[model samples]
Target: MNALSQTHSQGVVMTQAYLEIRDLVKSYDGKQQAVRGISLDIRKGEFVSFLGPSGSGKTTTLMMVAGFEMPTSGSILLGGREIAPVPAHKRNIGMVFQNYALFPHMTALENVGFPLRMRKTPAAEIARRAAEALDMVGLAAFGGRHPREMSGGQQQRVALARALVFGPDVLLLDEPLGALDKNLREQMQVEIKRIHRELGITTIYVTHDQSEAMTMSDRIAVFSQGVVEQFAPPLDIYQRPTTRFVGSFIGDSNFLDVTRQNDGLVAQGIGALNIAAPSQAGKFHGLVRPEAIGLWTGGDEQGHCVLSFLIEGLVHYGDSVLLIGSAAGLNLRARLPSVQASHLHEGDTIRIAWRENDMHLIPVQ
Candidate 1:
C-alpha cells in the first residue's frame, strides 16, 4: 500500500489508489530535466486532470503514463503492478491525441474496430462491439461515414469510440477538444464526462485550459515547471490554494503583500487590514478574488474591509462588469453584477468592500 492508503488521523483506513506515480522524472538531455520529480496517487474510477501551460511537463507526464515516452527515473504502478518497463502496445492503455488521429481513408466503423482487429479478435464479435461503441458515443448512424465526411466533433467522437472499443485498463486524453470551436468543445466536454460515467474507467486528462479542467475533473493536479504544485478537489484548490501560483493560474485574482504588525496584519500601501492573520504571523501574500469584492452602499461594515476604488477601466461581459483600478496605491480588480454597476463608469470613485473570510493567505516564498 502507498503512503496515501494508510489510516487517516480520524482512524479511517483509506482504500489503496488504483494508479500510483512515484518520483517520475524525464529529461531529454541528462543535464536538463524536462519533468522534475513528480508524484500522484489516483483512485479507481476517478477523473484526474494534469493542468499546466506549454513546456510545463503536463503533456510529458501524460506521455510517460501512456508508454509513449520513457521516464529517466521513477515508477508507474497500475493496480499495484509496475508498468514503466512495459511497451506502449502491451500496456493495454488507450490514448486520444489533440489532433483526433483518425484514419481518413477508413470508415467510422472500421476505424473504431481497428484496435480489436490488431488483437486478432473474431470478425463477428469485432463488428458487434464496434457498433456498440459507436452507439455509445452517439454515432451509430455515422458508422459508414469516413473521417472526411464528418464534422470535427463527430470525428472526435469516433476517436473516443475507437479508444474504448478495446476496453483498455486506463484511458489518457491529451487536449482532445483543443481543435474544436468553443461551443463544440463544450459539447464534447459533456459527452466525454457522460462516457466516463458510463464506463467507470480511471481516466487522466491533460489540458492547459483552466475552465476545462475545473469543469471535468474530480481532482486536479496543477503542474508547473515539471512539478506538481497542488493536487486537490476543485473547490479547495480555488478557495484555499496552497500556493500563490495556483491562485493566479486558476483564475482572476488580486494579490496583496501583507506584513504582520504587532497584533494585526498591514497590507503594503493599503494600511491595516481587518482580515485574520495566519498562525505564524510573518510576511504573507493575501489573495482576494475579484468576485468577492462588492460595491458598498453605506451599511454596517462589520467583518468587511472597505476601500475607495478609482475606476481606471470597466469591462462589460453581459452578465457581469469588471472594474480595474487602484485603491490607496494598490491596484485591484473587482467583478460585480452588471445590474449593480449599470450607472458606474470609468474614472468614477466608488466604495468597494470584501468579506474578511474571503481573503486567503499564502506564505511568501
Candidate 2:
C-alpha cells in the first residue's frame, strides 16, 4: 500500500504522508507535457525536497500537490482516498515562502494567530497557541513586534511560527530561506531541520540550492525537465549518482567520455581494468569525484588503476585544495585536504590514481 493508504488507517494518530501522488502529469500546452507522470510515496514525519533548477517543473508539481494547480492526469491520494478535487484550505497543509509573507500591519503574535482565527478558534485559545508557536521558533520576545520592526531573520522566524500555529500535518516550503544571506541561510537550514525533527511532520520543500537540499532532506528528489532523475540519500546522490545530471548536480566531478574496453570502460589518458560499471556504461560517460583521485606514484606498480597527469592549477577551499590536471587528453580534478596539499605546488608532475570502483559510468540519456 502507498503512504497515504497506510497513514489514513490510523487517523489523527500522526502517521506520515497520508498524502501521495501517483503517475501525476501536468502540462501548460496540450502538446507539451511539463510534469511527466511523477509518483512519490512520502512517509509520515519524513522531510523530502523536490530539487532542481528553474524550468525543471519542480515548482509546477509542487503547486499541483498543494491543490493550487490541477493535474492533467493521474490521482492525488490523501489518506488513501483521492483528493484531486479537494479545496486548498481543506487540505490542512501549512506553508512558508521565500518572502516571509507576514502581514506588515500586524504584530508577530497576531500574524501567527491568523490561521487559528480563520478556523474560528476562540480568541483566548488563538493567543495561547500563537504564543506557543512563536516560542517554538525562538521568537517569543518578538511576538508584539510587527514585521517592519524585525530583522529579516526574525521576520522569517515569525513566518515559520505562523505556518506552524495551525499544527498542520504537512509543511510545504517554497524556497522559504532563499532570501537570507549565506550565514543566515545556513543558520535557518539548521533551524528548519531541528523543527522538522521536533514536530515530526511530513514536509515537502522545493529549492534549486544543492547545498540546502543536501544538508536537510531525508531523501532528495533530483528533478530534471520536470522529471525525477534520482531520489536517494545525500551520500548516494553525491558518491554514487545514478545519472549524469545527478553527478553534475550534487557536486563537482571530472567526466571522461570513454568506450567499452574489456571489463571496464577505457578513458583516453587512463587505461582501465576490471570494474563492474553501471548497466549503462558502454554509452560513453565516466565520472570521477574530485576526492576520489589521489596523488599518483609511478613504478610498474600494478594495483587497481592509475593515471599520469601534469598538475595545471590548484584552488584552496578552506579545508581542502582542488587540483586541476590533464590525464590522457581529458581534464580531471582532484580534491585533497589542505594539510596533504601543503607539499604540492603548481606545475608539479603527479600521478593520480583511484580504485576501479571509485569511477562511475553514466548512461547517455
Q: All candidates: CA RMSD in angstroms?
A: 5.8, 4.1
lDDT for each candidate structure: 0.88, 0.82
* Cα lDDT of model 1 by residue, 257-361, tens digit: 989989898876667877778888498889999999999988888877789999999999999999999997889999999999999999999999888678888
Q: For candidate 2, what is the lDDT?
A: 0.82
Per-residue error (Å), model 2, residue 72: 1.9
- Please report how far candidate 1 places residue 297 from its true position, in Å: 1.3
Question: Per-prediction count of colliding residue pairs?
Answer: 0, 4
Best by lDDT: 1
Model 2, runs deviating above 4 Å: 1-16, 262-264, 277-281, 298-300
* Deviation from native of the Cα of residue 135 in model 2, angstroms: 0.1
